[model samples]
Target: MKKSFTLAEVLITLGIIGVVAAMTLPSLIGNYKKIETVTMLKKAYSEISQALKMAEVDNEFMEEWNFTAFENPDERVHHFFDYYLKPYIGTLKVCEPLEVGCMSDKIQHLDGINERPHAAGKMSFITKSGYSVLFWIHGDGTGGHFIIDTNGPHRQPNTYGKDIFRFILTFKNSSNVYADTAGYSKGLKAFGAVDGVTREELTGGNVSHAGLKPNYGCKSGLMGLYCAALIIYDNWEMRNDYPR
Candidate 1:
């Protein structure tokens, strides 16, 4: 008779394999998710940066662009998006102010407690590449915030610093002097402004930076406004200690 493994032996071997798989599967899945996040984030960043550069060639420097021509906030946001970004970025669809389709209805905090909806009167759109772009123009029109959702609005983990990142536009001006302190030369920059800062410094355990409240730095329990900067500081790779 051919020598075959006993049924009990075969069952034991299978049980051991199952235990090992169950232990390792979550880690493998998490790593894959991280890789996917990094890839999408890099693409979105590159696309937006290149689009801005191209827009400058046609509309002149962002600092010189006149958004004050429009009185209404919504109108200014729309004009800025339509005239400066939409053409270069190739948006697939534009969502009106406070619309639900283009962006997540509620964005959660990293701690997973607090939740906030998209800003009122801000124009948002979906890019052809599946990224969600939202614009919040300041009243003075000097600059504003750009919120990029790497996986679009419908995706899960709609929390900041994970799938959602924030960028700030500072139109160079004597009154508006973020470039000098933030170490970036103006125009657009990651929210924390990580030009000359290291990852540790950028994501330090502080709750405030340069007098900005709630400090958007990549620290846990805070609004992850500077998480993009942290990733950029790490050369676009999510560090091992990256908060989710």
Candidate 2:
């Protein structure tokens, strides 16, 4: 007779399968998180880059890039949002509760909006040391999986600086091109290199924003294509240097 497999046999098979899944599941999950982070970074950088380029057309690109001390912080911010950024970035506002992962305020206007705890509604930029451009996109950190500040202020990796707002490209009103301010700002920093050009000679310079790996240094392994794309695009500098 065609004998059927016993329940014990089936149970044992399932147990074996479960064990294999349990072992591999964590690895798969980790990889997924890494990919998600990288993808987010890439998209953020791309959006900011495009917006900045577009904004530059109508507004005069600032000669000097500095966010050290603003003579008129409020006005400078207003101008940036209304004149410089509004046209390019739709529904953009000074991220109220900047620390909060989500952009709670939907009001298009920046007036009377509650500011960040430390920032106090003051605006900043994200860019290279010499270059000047502010790229602070608003969004919540998705469970440590996504943080704009760490990636490229607002999502685009430009340069390094203390002031989160002072990006690689300078705003028209800002002062001289501030150098090495990528890490000063309170918001997340870029998780990759700057300018899509990473060279050994430039590795440890005032301009470098290196050691920006995704997954927050939790793990080091092969990242998915999407994640790599994000890093490559957002962290232009690192992407440039990598062999792959």
Candidate 3:
């Protein structure tokens, strides 16, 4: 006679399955999040790069954009965004510098202790594709910094080096003898690389490299400014040792 399993046996099998799923589900979810982060980061990078190239075509090179022409920092940032970037990047909503709503008021460092206040005079907006973008002109007005939240600011893990990443717009020619020797160009570059941090150092090959600042790098316990460069260097894939 053919017989189905008894209730006791069926319950035992179900219990084992539940136990296995409980053990594996978290890991699976974490990996999926990692993949999503990487994909969004790459997409944001590509979109910004293409926007810069297109802006250059119409507005001339970034270096010639005359950021200092406007005395007020807010005005300068607005001019830069309106005349150079907005046309190409296409913002869905624009928020005045450091205004609430568009960006988080305080961005947490990767280490989770230090927090960065959204400084005054820094413009922020949401991109057409849903990323939150913030722009800050350098102190000297020579270049600007672009920080993006790949999953938008409303999402969790607003911590740096996670959903948040940084890029630099270098308008001036490189003064770094090392960067020149390394054949790095001046334009848009990932944050650490703009400071002359090499790809190897960014990817954690040599975390102590002089160009790497304390509290900054792709590794855990640091600020995570170089995490974007690390991912880019690794062909847009988060490495196995990538800090969660």
Candidate 4:
């Protein structure tokens, strides 16, 4: 006759397995989300950068456009999209600037500081690739900014420096390109990157709406503005030791 374990022993083994899973599952899932966000962010950056380059190849020099001539901010925004972006940006729906119907009002400054405490955003559009484009033109039309949401407007982690990121654009001497605004916004209060700690503080560990990282000096008040550059600085990957 084959020996069998007692019912109590079988239950004990199963219970132990459950305990282990309960302890480890959340961490595993958290890491998975981090990886997912980074992947999409990298893809989004590459796509937008390439698209900008293509647009530059086809359009009139930005300064020549005289975007600021329009007194209405909304019209300035619209002409930029229609003239430079919508052609190859693969737009899905072009909504009125800052309209809740397309973009979320979730802009923040990183150090736990919210730009619009109530989530008021400006003009933007939804792209076919599942990202929202917050495209802006300077009043003078010599420069602009591109703020993108990697996971669309409605997804969780919609916080800046998490899913929402910015790209600065300028036109000089008839050449247009993205400026180096990839890291933290210039002149914001920063506390992480002292020596061995940096991007991870903003992009690594768990993300909270408050913008504070546990056990890390990365306060989100000013970090959201420039954290996208962290991915660029990290060579397109969020290394395990980030924010250390």
What C-alpha lDDT do the candidate models reach, one value each?
0.76, 0.35, 0.75, 0.59
Badly placed stretches (over 4 Å) of model 4 are: 60-68, 108-111, 117-121, 173-222, 241-244
Question: Which candidate, 2 or 4, would have the higher lDDT against the true structure?
Answer: 4
Query: lDDT by residue for model 2 over 1-244, one digit each (tens)?
Result: 9999999999999999999999999978856644554454445556655765676666554332233343444544454456545567544234432333222111111112222322333343333311222223222111011123334333332112111111232233211223322322222223332334343312222333432323212112222112222344444323423322
Query: What's the lDDT for residue 31 in model 1?
Result: 89
**Which residue pairs clash within candidate 1?**
none
- What is the Cα-based TM-score of model 1? 0.88
Alpha-carbon error at 115 in model 1, in Å?
4.1
Q: Pick the candidate with the highest TM-score.
A: 3
Deviation from native of the Cα of residue 148 in model 1, angstroms = 1.2
The window of 10 residues in a row where model 3 has the poorest summed lDDT is 176-185
Summed over model 2, clashes come to 45
Candidate 4 lDDT over residue span 140-228, tens digit each: 55556677788887886566666777666555431222222222222211222222334544454554323234432223334555466
Q: Report the Cα lDDT for candidate 4.
A: 0.59
**What is the TM-score of candidate 2?**
0.50
Please give the lDDT score at residue 231 for candidate 2. 41
lDDT per residue (tens digit) for residues 1-244 in model 1? 9999999999999999999999999999988988888898888888888888898998888778777677788888888787778889878888998887888888876766655556665888899989898877877666788888999998888888899888877766323243322444467777776344555556655433343334455778767877888887788877888887
- TM-score-best of 2 and 3: 3
Residue 63 C-alpha lDDT in model 3: 67
**Residue-level lDDT tens digits of model 3 in 7-101:** 99999999999999999999999889889888888777788888888988987777676655677888888787887778888677888976876
Where does candidate 2 stray beyond 4 Å?
A: 62-70, 92-117, 121-177, 181-230, 233-244
What's the ranking of the predictions by lDDT, best on top? 1, 3, 4, 2
